[model samples]
Every structure is written in C-alpha cells, then in structure tokens.
Target: MWRCPLGLLLLLSLAGHVALGAKQGRVRRELAPGLHLRGIRDAGGRYCQEQDLCCRGRADDCALPYLGAICYCDLFCNRTVSDCCPDFWDFCLGVPPPFPPIQGCMHGGRIYPVLGTYWDNCNRCWQAGNHSAFWGMTLDEGIRYRLGTIRPSSLVMNMHEIYTVLNPGEVLPTAFEASEKWPNLIHEPLDQGNCAGSWAFSTAAVASDRVSIHSLGHMTPVLSPQNLLSCDTHQQQGCRGGRLDGAWWFLRRRGVVSDHCYPFSGRERDEAGPAPPCMMHSRAMGRGKRQATARCPNSHVNNNDIYQVTPVYRLGSNDKEIMKELMENGPVQALMEVHEDFFLYKGGIYSHTPVSLGRPERYRRHGTHSVKITGWGEETLPDGRTLKYWTAANSWGPAWGERGHFRIVRGVNECDIESFVLGVWGRVGMEDMGHH
Candidate 1:
C-alpha cells in the first residue's frame, strides 16, 4: 500500500510557497504532511493569485470542491474497495505542470518528502484504470495503505509464544535454539490459516526480541507473518493464520517438539493425510495457505524487505540519534503478497488489506511495509484538515486511507522499531482444546 505518497507537485508547491511568502485565504494551522497544499497565505499577501504549482496532477479541486481552499485531495482520495481497481496514480502522471502520484513511491530505498501527487521512479506509469478506480479513495485509501491496522483479539504471555505465523509448508528448524539459561524456554508452535492469528505471530517475534531483553526481566510478544504462511496447522487462509493462546496450551503439557521430530499432519482439516512429508524448513507449501491474510509475496526475496541494518546502535551516543530520528524513520519498505481477506479490516486490526482489481494470484507480492518511527503527526491534510501521524509507504496495498495511502501510527505501538512478522495464527490452539 505504499503506492501513492504525498503528491510531488503538492510537495514542491508547499516548499515554494513557504520559501516565497505566497498568499492564501483563511489559512489553517501547520499543513498536514503527505497532503497537497497550494493557494495558502504568503508573507506578501493572503493568497497567491497565480498558479504557482503545475497542473499535471490537475483533477477536480482536491479540498472540498466548494470550499475554494487553495488545496484539496483528488477524487481518488476517499473511496472504498467496492469493485476491482485498475490503477489509480495516472491523474498526476498525465498532467504536465503538477505531477501525478505514483505507487511504490518509496520502495527503491529512498526517503521522499511529504510532497503532493509527485510521480517519480517506480511511481511513473499510465494511471487511467487506476486513477478512476480510486476516484474518491484518497482519505480511506491512505489509512488502508499506510497503517498496518491488522491485529488479533487475543494475547499471549510467554517467549514460547513464537512460531504461530509460519505458512503450512514449513516446520520448526531443528537448528532452532532456546535460551541458554532456561532449557525449557520453548517457543510457541502453531498451525496455518486457522485463526486469523497475526497477533500470535507478533507475539512470537516480539518474544524473541524480548528474549534478548530477558536479562532485564521483561518479555514482549509479537505477531509472526512467516509462521502463519508456513506453519499450515489449519485449513483456513488469510493474514489471520495462527493462535498464541493455543500455542501456549500445546506446550503446556508436551513441552515443545521439533516440526520434523513429530509426525502429525495438521489439526485443522483438509490435510492430504499426516503432516506433509516435510519439515518446517522443507518448503512443501505446509498447512496450505492459512495465516496468509496479509499479502507479502516475494518480500523476503530482497533481504531488505523486512530486517534492515542500522547505522547507529541503540546502546551508544549514536543510539540517541537513532531513537530521535531513525526509530521514527523506520527501517524498510516493500510490497508483501497477501490474500484479499485483509480488506475487511479498516482503521483497525488486520485492516490494511485493500481490494485488488486483478486476479488474487496475480498480486502475490502486494503487501506494504513501514518505517519504525517513534513519533509523528497532528499535522494538517491536503484539504486543510488535520490528523496525527503520516502513514509511511509499503509495497503492500492501498485503501481509502489518509492522503490516499497507508500509515504507521507512531509512538503508539512497537512500530518505532524494525518489525519482522514471525508467523500467523494456526489451529494448534483449537486442536489442543478439542474444538475448531
């Protein structure tokens, strides 16, 4: 959903106005980042009469049409995913003066300014089908594309909570290691696509991170996207892949078994027989595609898709710089392939899924990633409205979110740090409980 960032034309226009003291009417407070700002008050006058910015992104007025404000989000700024979409960033591209917004604007490893509708790099292309498809999707689309609103309702309380988000095809790697001090400090094991269990995966990953912090007497659970897609404990599909509570129960009695050391298939259903004759490392399309609601196909292909190397260490003076700037800036961005199911979540947990206009199998690499920012927002939008936090771009997908993009809510969750989706919810929890 990192498709369209702030319009480039709008960014340039804002910068120019700020520099030139152009005039605008009924000026609002500071401009909302990632918004298209124009016709604002300048030092010389209340409003600038000349069209300072280009018209390449020329669509109908973006701000409320009749408001006659200097700026407005385009028609594509506030619609929902009712039907299939073609392509949405063409409006700004076709125009000459002001450029159109483009998708994947920030993926190629570059941090862009919060410009308005500026199309460049991987963002340039024909936007006919896309533009009209999102005729009124700027607002919601941005939220969908920017914010990774997906989540699970349940929570876990242990480091063993890891391992639920793998796909149905994989098994726990025998090479997996446990805490050196606590031999029984097992990680959670899970199934695939059963519980819409991103929370489980999150728990696992965070547990790992917290494990590193275990010496401090603390543990933080995280969702695991990998296990959800790979574990395959259940027959269901989508981002909601595994369960943490179930994982807890699985290990409660049995301790923890290796993915291959055990011979059981899946506890969910639709299995050919016993577990596919493969290990978590086997890659046999384990547990089917449960836990695969978020679309992040081929993301791991690029090492930079998830984990990123930091230039500064958090334990040193440079660490302060990281906390102040880099943490909020995040580490990476890209498109994750996921199922269309995520669309159901809007402005909430697992709400990042967007309507794919193409065949489901086609956008296998369509998930969005974000920068781990510590804090941001309370700024204005393109149409003179204000909101907190600007959703960073990811290759994932888009929704009718803020500024026609998805965003990361800074300073709220663990989003400020680099996040790796470990695995999703699986059926182990349900199976151990004797219910599905």
Candidate 2:
C-alpha cells in the first residue's frame, strides 16, 4: 500500500476542492489569496512531480494544490475547463502537453487573447490562436486602408497624348535630380500623413517645381495640396482618395493658392472623414485666369494669389522620353502600384519583390499611388547587372526613403509607373513675372 506524506495529502485534498469550486461557478478558494499563479510553474515549484501522486483513473482524490489554486492529476481534468497541473501529462500520462501553457500573448505590457490583433502604422499584427506564430494585415485590408490613388477611367487615361519626344542624336544624361539641377526651385517633399491625397500632393508638388522652374526661380512657391483636397470636389473624394486626372483638371480650371495662403489640414481630420470645408474661393479674371476672393486661411500669411498650370500632358512609357522630359522641364507626375513591401522601403533601387508569392492571396495586395518622378539613374551591381531606376519624390515627407525620395527600378514599366506619366507647364506670364 502506497501512502503519501500528511502535508502532501492535505494539499491534494485542498486542490480537489478548489477545482470543484471552479467547476461549480464559484470563486476558487486559496490559502494565499494574494499570490500570482497563472503560469505553469508557481513559486513553490514542482508540486506534482515531487509528490509522485498521479492518479491512474478519474480518481476524486488525485489533485495538487498549486500556488493559490487547484490543478488536477487525473486524465479527466483535461477534458473540460482544463485544471491539470503543468507536469500532469508528463508525469501521469507519460506524454507532453498537447499545447503550451494557455498564457495569453503579451504586447506592450498588455495581454491579448489568441487571435487578437493591433495595427502598427500600415501594418496589422495578430497573436497566433493555437501556434507560436504571428500574422499581419491581409492584402485586401492594406489596399483599402493604407492606399488611396484611384485607377484612372479609360476616358481620363487616354485624354492626353505623349507630350514629349526624344531627340535621336541628342544625348541624355545618365543621372538627373530636379533639386540638384534647380536649387531652391524644387519644393521639398511634404508629408501626406495618413491621408490618401497623393493625387493632390503629387499634383501640387509637380506644379510647384514646374512653376518655379518656368518662372526662372523668381516665383518659387510651394503650391497647396489642401486647396486641391478641399475645393476639388466635382468628381473627387478629397483625402479619402482621388484621381490624378481630376486633380489636374481642378488645378487647370479653378487654380489653387500657394501653400502659405491655404495650408494643409488633411492631417487634422480622420482618414475617413470629409476634407475640411473649402476655405478659399476664386473669381474668373477676363482671360483664362482667376483671382482668389477669400483671404488667406492662415491669418499670418496674406498672399492669396492663385497659381495655375497648363493642361497636363502624358508621356510615352519609354524611359528615355520620360528622362528627357524631366531634365528639360521639371518633375513629372506618375501613377504606381504600391505593394505591401513598398511601405517598408528605406533606400536603394526598389522593385516589386515576389516574397509573398507562396503566401495566401490575402497577404499579397497592392494599390495605386501617385508620385513625382524627379530624376533617373543607373546602378551597376557587383554581378555586372545594370539596374536602371527612377528617382521619385514621395509625399510621405523628407524622413522617408532617400530624404523623401525613393529609387524604383525603371524601364520595363515597373509598378506601372511609366504606364501613365504626365507633365505640365506653369501658367507663368509677364504679369506673374513682374509681380515676383
């Protein structure tokens, strides 16, 4: 006959009573009420193993008093509302536990139940429900929430013809940067924040550069994307998302005041909310020009003169033509398919990686984005591969990739960036030149 130590037997009986209390919807009674006891091993250490008191069947007496609660030693304990001691399976059943201890996943000092998720910027993360794994946002969710450029309608895409042609004999430079070529003329990259108004930001950036260059640096104004986001409401959705064609149309027809007059308010509102109300208005001048009728939105700045651009013209998908146009004029606007990995870009020539190929389709997602194609260059890899890239300015601010710029693999229509490239001339004239 096997007999247990008197103290050990008492603990076993107490553990059984605690388990019974738990099963009967009552608070588990404990001698040490203030002790912490959720983990596999408690402060006392190795209760079931040291006692060697595992029961062979569903024996009522087979239980262990853990730190402050009860854990069972019989097989029946694991069937429902598992209260088995950490070592019950190993010592009693001669097998490892089916799963690791049921401690919830910990993040930022908070415990999240299995399958709980949280978003970190554009990426979403979740705890593994049953396995020791983590997952991120689905591709569909990434496209829906993180990206905002709308695919152009066939009518809008074909409206403009290629506006520039390459000279057969004239040589094109191997590298070019708008900021370097025309110092102080190219506007610094601006942060769009979480707003999906790249349509407005890119259009405004390209217009700003072209206006300054066309005016010979005399009228270097940072044009307002907010003007476009709020006022260009005919066929646009403001920060929610918009089309470049519509944005350009608004810039040409109505015109926008400089950034000083109407500052950006897109960052202050919810990404899903409507853009701030149209704060600035304009009246048509005698010619195809207009004048702002409202005072500057920012009280400190008084200048409210409207800036306009010639109708935007598209460029052929040929890289040389795009480069030639950029060098001769200024930065041009281009549409691109932004993939999940694009958000993580830090630097270097970027090409869409196929890392998500084997993963589920939910993990592979992309959305259209508009950017300013500022320059172009070629990088020769150690393996003697020449990787041509476009130096594009993103609206994500100067802190992001390459000082607010990113180099993407050029030519081969990477990310459809070259598919629908566009350029425009600032509507600068003698009157505008005289004032500046």
Candidate 3:
C-alpha cells in the first residue's frame, strides 16, 4: 500500500505479467555436447549434473524443453519462466542472463543486495493492470513526477536558535525510538493506499504523535488525514499529492476534527481513484470562523472534537538537533527521496547505493516521499565503520518494509531526510493538564 508518485501512477497502472511470446523454437530429442537435462527423467524435481554441463547444484537442473532447444532466456523469461532449468542450462553453457526482478531477504539480515529490475509480479501492479510498480520507473522520471510540485523553502522554519541548543548529555542517544520509549504516544502505522497522499499522511501522523507525547498521553487521539485530504484544497492538492508545508499550514490555521468525525475515504478504493470532492461535513468542521452551511446536515464544527496545531516550524538539518527534538517532544515529519531498490527492502538499516549485485543502473533515487521520523540508532559494520540510522514510519501498511517501519542511513543527510524536518505544537486540552 506504499503510495507512488503521480506520474508513476499511470505507468504503475499499466504493469502486469507480459507474455514472453518467444515463438516456441523446435524442441530437440537428441542430446547436444556439454548439455545435461536433469529432473526430466524422474519428473520428481531431483537434481543431476554432468561435468561438461557444469551444473552448480541441485537447483541447477537443465530439464525438459530447455534440455536441447536454444531456449530464449530473455528478461521477461527470467522473471516468469516456469522452469528453473533454463537458467541453469544457460549458465552451464556460459550464456549470461538478466538477474531476476523479485528476490528474498532475511527479515533482519545485516547484508542484503538491492535488486535493480522491476518486480514482475507486484500485487499492486497486478491489481492496477500494470507491468510494474514504483520500482519500474527510473529515478529521473520518479523525481519529476513526485517532487515536481514541492516547494523547498516552504518547509524552512525560523526556530534555528531555539531547539538547536543541544545539551551535552542529551545530545542524542546512540539509538532511540519513540514507539519503544512512549508507545502510548506513538500512533499506529497507517496505509495511504494507492494514492500519492503521503504528504497528508505523514504530516497528520507526526502531529498526532507530538500531541500525545506533549500531553503525556492524557490527550492521545489519532488525527485524521482524511480531513486534510478532503478539506485542505486551497493550498494542498488532495490525492494528486501535496506539500508538507501546506498540510501543516492547514492544521495550524483551519484545524481538524478526529478521524471519527472525518473518516478516511481515499484509502477505501484499491485502485486509488481520484480524491473525493471535499465533504460538506468536513469542510464545515475544518473552518474556524465560517458558519456551517445551514442546509448541509452534520456540518457544524464542534469545539470538543476540533484539534489545531500552533506554531508549526521546520527543524535545522543537524542530525543531533533533529534527534533532540524527537527525544524532547515526539516524532517529526521528514521529506525524502527514494530509490528503486527500496521496494525490495525487507529489514535492517538501509542506505542508497549506486548499484546492487554489480548492476550499474540499480538503486537510483526514483521519487520523493515523506515519513515520520520516530527514532535514531547506530550500528557497527564488519569493516568497523559506525553506521548511524534513522527509524522512520512509512505510510504503507504494516505488511511492508519492516512492519511499516524502515531504518535509513543517518547523520550524512541521506536522501535529504535531514533537510526540511518539521515540528508543531498540538492543541492542548483541559484533560491533559493534570497528566503533564
């Protein structure tokens, strides 16, 4: 359910299992020199090797139609080929084939290669009738599609002199997590569905976390991204995507009701249809002074249900300063760019690399995205280099990217994550006073 960019939406919509359609070459009955077809005789999926064929192991079985035919091991074939024997046969004969698109990785392994090619069987693409998903788009195309509308300076705040003052002991822990230290304050990971509404999701999630943490859990409540997506059309684009600045600005000025009052509809559709028209009920609830349209039913703003953010400001790019804010207040929203290999990420610390498995065109920064920065940590690599990482919450469902969370290389401003961090003060309630 991880959201893709607007431009990728069209391409992602077209991704699917393309038929290789390699005009079935004539099948050969006689064995050729240095060719060994294993598992064909038994058909029970056993391995056999010949010295001339050079089968590496059990999986390298050259069986059936691939045994003698000049099988076309093309890119699509490598992705969707029914038999594993052709790959083995090609390898034994010194024929190089493109790497498979989809790969497996241990849940928490330290070492995993980033896959280059698009996943041939992405469920999202299948659902959308597309041949690929986010991984299919090139870096430049993704960047232009996703970040084309973002305004850089809009995220900058004037609070540099205030939170940048990091004390010696409280600078930053080697590792920290808002969810671990303050589970009550951390909201659950949310799914943006197929829409590019990550700006709204991340902004609302960070604000919700900050509200709960600042109020010491007394005023904990899940804020509504639907409210922003449906009602904040003046400065923000609903499903076509929006900027973090505009989302925060909407929260500060217009305010929003709880999710119960303005439930999310953008995610209800798996196809990620266009954003629904601004609901009359939500619009009336979000506006401060505007009276509810008398003819519109259930369109009144209630003081008890309404919540507003005050003094939303951007944080400096300093890593320790960002950590200090999270430790003191709560999670902050991070604007970032992503690479294609990110789709293959399962777990462990992630850092962008130029290539994966020696493929020079892999892992390029493909698109812009936003997430909630909840924690920070450091890990020691085998080479003795200290790898600092940031724990961020994704808009995709918990089924993806480490249970809806990911750790990226930190301190060096990887993917511009350190740049344009934003924080805000949530509306305080009377019930929260005693708790704090």
Which candidate number has the best TM-score? 2
TM-score of each: 0.24, 0.68, 0.65
lDDT of 3 at 389: 88
Better of 1 and 2 by TM-score: 2
Residue 313, candidate 2: how far off, in angstroms?
0.5
lDDT of 1 by residue, 1-436 (tens): 1234543321222222222111222232123222232212112111112222222332432232111123332333323310001112222233222323333224234323221222332121211112222233343343333233232233321223222233466442211122232333323332322223333233333333333233232222223344333443443232323343333332221122222233222333333334332122221124321222232333332211111111211211122222232222222121132333322222311222222333234432333322222123344434554334323322222332222233432223323222322221222322223344
Against the hidden true structure, what lDDT does model 3 obtain?
Answer: 0.58
- lDDT per residue for candidate 3 within 252-328, as digits (tens), equals 77666666556677644333456676653423433342222222223453433556777777777889888888887
Superposed Cα RMSD, model 1 = 19.3
Worst 10 residues of 3 by lDDT: 37-46
- Model-by-model lDDT, in order? 0.27, 0.71, 0.58
Task: Report the C-alpha lDDT of model 2 over 165-204, residue by residue, as the tens digit.
Answer: 6667888888888889999898888888667788899999
TM-score of candidate 2 versus the correct structure, residues matched by position:
0.68
Error of 2 at 22 (Å): 44
In model 2, the worst 10-residue window by lDDT is 125-134
